[model samples]
Each structure stands twice: as C-alpha cells, then as structure tokens.
Target: MSTRTYLPYIACAAALCVAQARADVKIGFSAPLSGPVAAVGQDQYDGFLLGLESVGGKLGGQVTTVLREDDQLKPELGNQITRKFIDRDKVDAMVGLGFSNVLMASLPRIAESGTVAIATNAGPSPLAGAGCLPNVFSTAWQNDGTAEAMGKYAQDTGFKRVYLMAPNYQAGKDYIAGFKRHYKGQVLDEVYTQVNQPDYAAEIAQLQAAGADAVFVFYPGGMGVNFVKQFSQAGLGKKLPLLSAFTVDGTTLPALRDAALGTISGAMWDVALTTPGNAEFVATFAKKFGRTPSHYAAVGYDAARLLDIAVRKVHGKTADKAAFAAAVKAAGTELKSVRGPFRFNTNNMPVQNYYAFQTVKDGEKFGVKLLGTPLSQHQDVYVAQCGAK
Candidate 1:
C-alpha cells in the first residue's frame, strides 16, 4: 500500500531529476577524436555543426560557439578534458556526446554543475534508469533499444542459437542485455574483449569452435572495423550469421567494405532514411564530406535540432535548466524522428521504432540497407517503470 514499497529508487531519481532542470543555457560539444574512435567523433561533430549552420550559429537569443575536445577514449583523459571544458571554456551546456565510457566518467561533473547535456549519442541504460539525471536529455536511444531490435529479428527469423560478443564496458553490457531481452534462444557463448582491441583472432577461433547458428555483437567506432575484418579473417563469416547494434556504422563501414557483407544491424536512423529532413541531411553531409551518414550523424543532427527547439521555446531565456529540459523532452515528443516517429519516456530516452538493416554491396559502393519490421515501435518500457502519472 506504500509508494516506496511499490516503486524502485530509480523511479524516485527520475522524478528528482525532472524537478531540478528548470534555468541559462550555453551548450558544449564533447566527443572522441585523434584516436581509434575519431571517425565516430568527427561524424557526430559534423552533424552538430550542420545543425548550427541551419540556425546561423545562434541558439535562442544567445550566440553559441561549440568547444570541441578529444576524449582519446580514456576514462582519465575524458575526465580531464571535461573539467577543462567546464572550467575554462565557460560553456553553459553540453552536446554531441560520442561514446559511453567517456560520457560515464564525465556525467557526475555535468550533474554537479547542473549543465544541461544534450546526450547526442551513447545512451547507457543506467542513465535511462537508476542514474537518470535531469540536466542530461538524450537525443538518441539507449544501446539496449537498438540491440533489442536485432534480438527480435533473430527470434522472428528462427535463429535457435546465438553467440554474442562486445568490448567490455558499460555500453557493451547494455548491448548484450538488450539482445537477451528479446532473444530467448540458447546462447552458445558470450565473449567480452578489451575495449577497442585491434585483434579478434582468439575470440574468433572460440566463436568458430562454438558453432552458433548466429552471432550478435556491439562493437562501435574502430572496434567494429577491427572485429569485422577479423571475423572475416577467422572465417566465421562463412560459418555464422551476424547481427549487430553499433558494430558497423557510417564511420566504420567504409573500412569494413567486403568484410561486413551480410551483417545485420539495428538503429533509429540511417543515411537511407526516406524522410525529407533525413534526405536533406544526407545530401548535405555527402556533399560537404563526400560520404553517406551513419546513425552518429543523425544523432548529432537531432541533438542540434533538439537544442534549437529548447532555445526557441523560451525565446531569449536559457538560464532556466528545468525549462530547457522540458523543451528538449517536448521536442522529442513527436512523429518526425529521423527513422520515423519518435517519442520520449520519463527516463529522458527515446520511445521510437527499431530499424533493421543489413550491410550489402550496391553497385560500386557498400552500405547498410533497410530490411525488416520495427521491434519496439515508438515505445520504451521505461516510462511505465517511471510511473510519471
């Protein structure tokens, strides 16, 4: 009969966060660059930059210049870089987050400083659940959301046994958890490797020895390129079907070319999304950068759009964190998502469709193509868990 008895601490935390984000906003863009993950970082940056260009470099009535940093994919380095940005750059807000580990290390500082974070990428599940913070509003879905889509695909397609792999980290765990939620089949093996380790010979050997009907992985950035190359090298590509979330993207797909053939992936958006906004974005990105976009670009674009909406809501008043968060949340609460319809749950993550795509060769180029049905269909279970009513 008691409220505490019926609900968990995470629900309480979500409410507390929603209450605190009501004040001025300057926005900062932090991501990984000058390292193995640099490709993803750069794409994210380009997308945010494009958004700023659309609005003429001004957010609301305030002039905004992005302060970009290289996290180098190291936790310590990420913390230090974030500190320097907050202390020296005089930024009032943050956006275009690239990876989970980097975001994890810097989240406390963001929460402590009460600086609104536009969470463009890397939605680790804790932030969507127990660790949800009001100052942080995500433009991307959590890692699990996409992984869950692939898992359902596996289930629907009659894959009875699946082998899984991921670089050991918060995002990796979230990725596996997402897949398992929809896949009730036998797990032949679960392999966790060093984050961004360039070689997969040993793991590939083991996966080949396991003889799984299918394989699901969550490597992103450089790790994805290396894994795909090594998976092909180990000859597992001939032996197993591969399903992935964040394993192959626009940043890594060029490098993955032939190696990633036949691989399946899930996400909220891809460069091939047919929406007018997405088509415009892809056309602009390809002309500007001479390449197609990955989900990172779409997220970056969304983050910028998300920020623009928040600024427009209050006109010239950005010092209100709660107002900013509300505006961002409302901005996401519609059907104009890059992939299609997108909504927001109480946890500040997206309630959107999960798209299934496959890596294939088309004429002289290689890229992922849309393939199957949506798994979640504009829904995230977290809102029910949050008990917003």
Candidate 2:
C-alpha cells in the first residue's frame, strides 16, 4: 500500500556530510512533461526548476543536477522513467512528479533506491499513512485535502441534495470521499467517468437528470475545460449552480474564459490573495507568463520556494539522504505559505487554508478571484489517519 523506502536512519549532519562530499547529487523530476496534462506538468516543472535556479542548483547544502524525465501521464511510462532517474542517471533524490498515478508508480522506485523523493505536486493518500516513507515528502497538499474543505463548506452552508462528479480513478475517488466526509448531505448522486474523456455529454445528461440543488466536481486540466464548456452549453451553469475545488483555477480558466464566470471554487489562494508574498508572485508570474498565475502556478512557485529554503537549510548538501529529508521537512514547517500558515501533518501532507473562489473577467484577461472567503483554514480532516502528532 505504501512505496515507503526503508533506509537505516543516520545522524542528520552525518548523512548530509556524505551527500555534500558527492560531486553532484542528482535530483529526479518525473512528470507529464507532455500530453493533455502538460500545462499542469509544465507549471510544476517551472516552479521546481525555478527553485533550483534560485538556490543555484544546490539542495541541502550540496550541489545538484536535476535529472528530468517525462512520464507522459502513464503509470508504466512513469515507472520506466523513474528507473532511469534512479539507475542510469544515478539520482540521489526525486521531486516534482506531477500526477497521482505517476507518483504512485515512482514511490517504490524511490523507496528501493534509498533516494529521497520530494513531491512538489501529487500527494496521494496511501503514502500518507501506513505506507508513508520517511524518504517521501510533499510540498503540495494531499489529494483529498482541498476537496475535504469543500465538504466542510457544504456542511457550514447547509447545502443538501448536492451532486458530485469526478474522473473515475484513485484521485477522483479520494476527492469525493474527502468531500462526503464533511458534507453530511443528501448526495443526489456520485458519478465517475473515464479519466480525460474530452466530452462530458453522457455525464452531463445524467447530471441534468439528477436534478441536484448544487454540484461539486474535481475535473482538472483538459477535463475541466471540457466539463465547464459543456456545463455552460447545456445550460446547467445557471440552473444548478456549480462549485469546484479551485483546481479549475489559473491553469484551465483561460480555456474556460467567460464560461467560468459566476462558478464557485475552493482553494487556498486566488490571484487576489492580498498579501506581499502573493502580490509579488502574482505580479511576476503574470508579467513573465503573460497571463494570470493560476493556483497551480502559485503552488508551483511555492514548491520552488519551499525547496529553496530546504536546500538552504542543509546548505545544498543532498549527499546525506536522511539529513536532506529532515532538512526538507524542517523547511516545510518554516515556510510562511502564501496560503497563510502551514505545517506538515504526520502523513507529510499540508495543513493549510482552502478558500472558495470564483472566476471573474479581468479586463482583457481572466483570473480566479476570491469568493465567499476561505471555507477551511489549517484543515485536513484525513489527519486522523495521517498518524501526525
């Protein structure tokens, strides 16, 4: 159930010392470097790489060369790609595996090789509990953590007869499970479909038939683009009112355009998260990327920042895998996350705010704007099973 690596523990400094002595500690980055989810993967890639650049290619006080590979969003491909990073590339650590399926496949590879795996994205559940490895750490929130915020919101707002839909897969199931944990409502229906099915006609037909008062969905990347477009075209946008996990934020919002208007989403930060850190990040990203930074980009940037801080903690010395892992964990605790304060749960997932957001037209551009305030703050109910103190 867990791809946890079992390496004998060592003194933090000792482990770091060994790693630092190595000429160049290699870090592996396995992600959807191509395919439909490339936008999401690219965002993650840019953030982590940016962090590497910012820190001068050193992590934990040791100089590093990032060995990048494309999983192409396939689990088997992910396994093969990870093998190359671990075996041929001789990487000492891994980071930025973008998708859940890819993360699941790569975990065992990391565990077996005694390499630290720092996830910039994709925090699947199994790794958080019984399967948790001391070697694997996430700079991103877990799979269901954000959806759990929506569940709590539904409970707070008193929305009964809500319909839920997601791509039929491990992550999709986890998202709905997290929502139902707090929702305590009449779930009109819980629907699932094949992952990345461009057309949601069949599901939309079923949704229209379900006649729920409100709907919650977890469709990211191209799937989000298609679902939102179909929802608007089918006239469900007005009648049912849509609420989302804010994963439908900056990345896919451009694709949805005006159709995303008026829909409610849940996230930790919007383009409007009025803070100095957020303002600088949003401004820089928009100017450089020529578009608003979606929550994905924001998280990507945050991941890079977190990595930089952690690398600095160990002085870029990744030779000591155990020390590097501890340094990363300590760094995570210290980050003044743009979403506000955050700390790692025992399961190594994030406990942070999840806000409700809306897509609004920003003149010639579109962005995810704040809506209804933050629903869940420093929240991740799955923590009960997370084995955190």
Best by TM-score: 1
**How far does residue 184 in candidate 1 sit from its true spot (Å)?**
1.1
Q: Tens-digit lDDT track for model 2 on 1-389? A: 01211111255542221232343456677777676677877777666654444444444445555556777888888888778877887776677776787788777878877677767666777876667777787767777877877877777778888999998877888889888887888998899988878898988999899878789999877888889999999998778878877447777887888788878887767777775577776666666567766666666666656766766777766668778777777777887766776777776777777777776676876766665553444645455665542
TM-score of each: 0.89, 0.88
C-alpha RMSD by candidate, in order = 10.3, 6.9
Q: List where candidate 2 sits over 4 angstroms from the true fold.
A: 1-25, 56-63, 362-364, 372-379, 386-389
Q: Give lDDT for model 1.
A: 0.75
Which candidate comes out best when scored by lDDT?
A: 1
Tens-place lDDT per residue, model 1, 1-389, is 00000111244543221222212344567777777888888888888776655654555534555667777777777777667667776566677665788788888887787667877777777777777877776778876888889888999899999999998999899889888998999988889999879898888888888868999998888888888898888777766888988788788888988888998888888866686678887888888778888788788877777677778887857667677667777777642556677767777777777889888898978977789655755555454454341
> Residue 31 in candidate 1 has what lDDT?
77
> Where does candidate 1 stray beyond 4 Å?
1-25, 381-389
